[model samples]
Target chain A: MRIVASALVLSIPILTAAEAARGETLTVTLSHHQVRITSTYTGAELAVFGVIGRDGATAPRSGDYDLVVTARGPRANTVLREKRPFGPVWLNDAQVKFYDLPVTMAVLSSRPLDEIADVDLRRRYAVGLDTTRASNIAPPGAAVREEEFREALIRLKTQSNLYVQDERGVSFIAENVFRATVPLPATAPPGAYEVEAALFRGGVRLAVTQTSFEVTKTGLEQFLAREARERGLLYGAAASALALVFGWLATVVFRRD
Target chain B: MEFYLPIAEMPVHVGLVLAMSAAVGFISGMFGIGGGFLMTPLLIFIGIPPAVAVASVAPQIAAASTTGVLAHWRRRALDLRLGLVLLAGGVVGTLLGVLFFNAMRRVGRLEPIITLSYAALLGTIGGFMLVESVRAVLRARNGAVVDPRRRPRPRWFGLPFRMRFPQSKVHMSVIPPLAVAAAVGFVGAVLGIGGGFLVVPALIYLFRIPTAVVVGTSLFQILFTAIAATLFHAATNHSVDLILAMLLMFGGVFGAQFGAQAGKSLKGDSFRLLLALILLATAARFVLDMVVEPREPFSIMLSEVLP
Candidate 1:
């Protein structure tokens, strides 16, 4: 009761002054305990980092701050609020910092690897008409580039919701490397969705950020299907048969013996 | 590799290793072969390094073999005097084998050697033992039995170190048995097998030890060979990985015990023939691999599977 009374008396004088506030710096990171990769090193990931602290000029540790961080978009919003329960992360005596982390806050997809290219069909679909002029401007074999936007057209055709990074009190290390990905499941909603980055400290909301990306899923399946027409169905059947035999033998000897 | 884990990993479960050891124990006991013959390869196929698998198998081999020997001893099947002679040779041979193993590692060719050895050795031995046992089985079916009441042969009367073996009922020199023991030890060293297979053959064909005692006596010597191998690997090369090895051994011991019990009901020659056939088949596969140029040399061929 005495400690509460003293804090109340101290805050009363400060509350009346109503001074403007600033920002606070807190370091954030993640620590992964163990990681394993498949025999085929196709999948990889980026680590996410989150830091949380308060501005001494205005809001203290217990005070709320109207933090705004320019991130990809809002889906990162969910990750931004409240410190979670005990995880792989380690905390010091102060409980205000995170250390030597593992995965960063981004995941980049890998491409379809091919050992042999019998026919050059990696390029199949062209978005938009190239406005017709660019196709004429190029050499006979080359398809000219179109400066006109194709995303708006895609948006009308499919419900496109691109994820953008925007949040309060979250700074993201932007990964600008564009990736060529083939969708695995067609059920995946093709639209623009917000990619949010969040920060939580000591079980409290501290910061967040968001980003946006357009979902492009067309002609992806054709890449796998292209040149098989020349090989015919017999080879595919034989290959599938061999694969089944191999898989069976592998399971026989290799299953948790 | 620097050995890892026992008390290190979280949620420490020695129970898993212990249970596995028991299984390995059972199988090895039943088969009358140090399951290490199978353990190392099986572990590696599952991604455990060969060194760790071998190291772990040693301890479990000792444990399970002890149990097997105890049971056999109770049945008066084991010959302690024979085991002692074999141990002396085995300890020496194990040291040499560990040395060679290290040297092979330095050359980066242990895989080929190991692969070739397992495929060739087991397949050949299994095949030969199977054929021989089949013949004996056929003869027994025909009711052609050797007279058991005949006086003991004194063929080794002229040989040195002549001594009486009341169980064997022979007044013969100890030199042949010692030589056989030493030769088996040498092979066991190079192959990383417990030498039980070789010992059984020696007892049957050369030393004329009774077929009934072959399993028990070979197992007796195997315990010693395993101990020596474990110590040698531990002391000299530090090749024995206690953690991984123990994990494999744990499973192996239990498997061996159950195998031993199962083996108990089988006829002598039939059991021998089956064991030999397994050896031959596995060995033949190894040899075939060496001779048959696989379509893809770089294929992901698993040597063992995960437990």
Candidate 2:
């Protein structure tokens, strides 16, 4: 009986030690939960702050930690077209449709994505814009190369300030803590956005923490958008009437004596 | 002077936009046409998206046409009977135009198609107008009374459905006027213009309507066509930016007042010559854009996913 009791005590410490090495814990805080788009809305900056610790401990060692932060807008289907010379004129030669792609994406990492993760890992996690390919569907019998279209899509998105990648965008302020600031351009579509902070150790994912926020129109913009989507006929009628009235008023005001 | 455009979701310099609209409006007022051809391209160049630029300019065309119509009404220059027939054809053309526009948009080919068509159409029309106006100016300088009515008639003038337009004192087949107006309306809807520039010339040269009646009749038809265009854009594409339209109309109306006063100072031949030159210049720019290789050869557009 005594031997059995000693065995139980020995196994308890071993189990606790195993649990300690199981995974890291992550917590995230954002500057704002909702972005209000008003008349003067040009663009906005969001500061994402997070901390990583192992098994509920206060802080993890600096050398053992690597962080990657990504912020992505709502997923939507997108079509990318490539223009090529057809005879003497330029025409749309090829197109690729990407399903469930983020309209805007920003990736920030402690180091370059290739340096931090292997090809499979990067592809799985979509660590960089180049590595991200979410179900690109091409037309049947299209002779165009898929890789060329995908690269062109990324290039176009980057030029529009929609897809961004910064090798050193994330910085460690102290051991186990990191922060990043993402800039959303004026052209960013209004929708829900997800911000993810992933903790890694030696090229392996430890833990991932996620938070979400919303971007929405307000005031006159909100009313106009609702009218357009919901009561389209009424909106059209009103717009036409307003135009007519303005035209008549202008004529009357500027009429010669 | 920056003002936020709620619908466009961007901030623009109030002074710059107002001045630009005013300048275009002045030209429209002097020409007695909707300035949409100039307005849409200029708006796009100033960073407005092509869809939004095309849709938003419809209301401005409506407003400018209304002003022109009122002025012509005061002068008793409109042929109401002829205007009605042109508008009847315009309605059908606009409906078809909107459908074609949406189909092109579905294939993500709207921008390039619009640009290419603009280049071709503007080049042809501007070239013809330049030659005609230059000849008119030279004839006036030589003190020769060149009567437009004495010009050789087109072969198609003898087609069926002959009708009498008493106001302009002409008897011709109705098909030519209707077909011409329909063609102009189609281009107008696609390009976000009032079709006034095209319609005015067709009335004067093709249908041989008097110059005095042509401007008023063109304005009358454009007012209705623009109204249809505004409704179609709003209901179908939801792309009509009311804030942008209102700002442009505000400047356009005021500028038309000054343009009318300025028109009084210039001779008819000189005025036509100046307009022709401007048209040629605008068309040249479009041609240059088409022939030149773009820096970026790829474009991104939103795709409609099956629900």
Best by TM-score: 2
**Best-performing candidate as measured by lDDT:** 2
For each candidate, what is the lDDT?
0.44, 0.76
Give me the TM-scores of chain B across the candidates.
0.75, 0.86
Clashing pairs in model 2, backbone N/Cα/C closer than 3 A = none
True contacts kept of each: 0.00, 0.61
The clash tally of candidate 2 reads 0
Tens-digit lDDT track for model 2 on A143-237?
35888778888888888788999889888876766778777877777889999888877899878878888878888888987887677678878
Which residue runs of candidate 2 sit more than 4 Å off their true CA positions?
A: A1-23, A55-60, A140-144, B1-13, B92-125, B150-175, B186-194, B210-212, B278-286, B304-307
For model 2 the local lDDT of residue B216 reads 74
> How well does each candidate superpose onto the true structure, as a TM-score?
0.50, 0.85
- Across residues B151-247, which tens digit of lDDT does each residue of candidate 1 receive? 3654654489776765554556777776667666666666666767566666665566665466667777777666655555555434344344445
**In CAPRI terms, where does candidate 2 land?**
acceptable
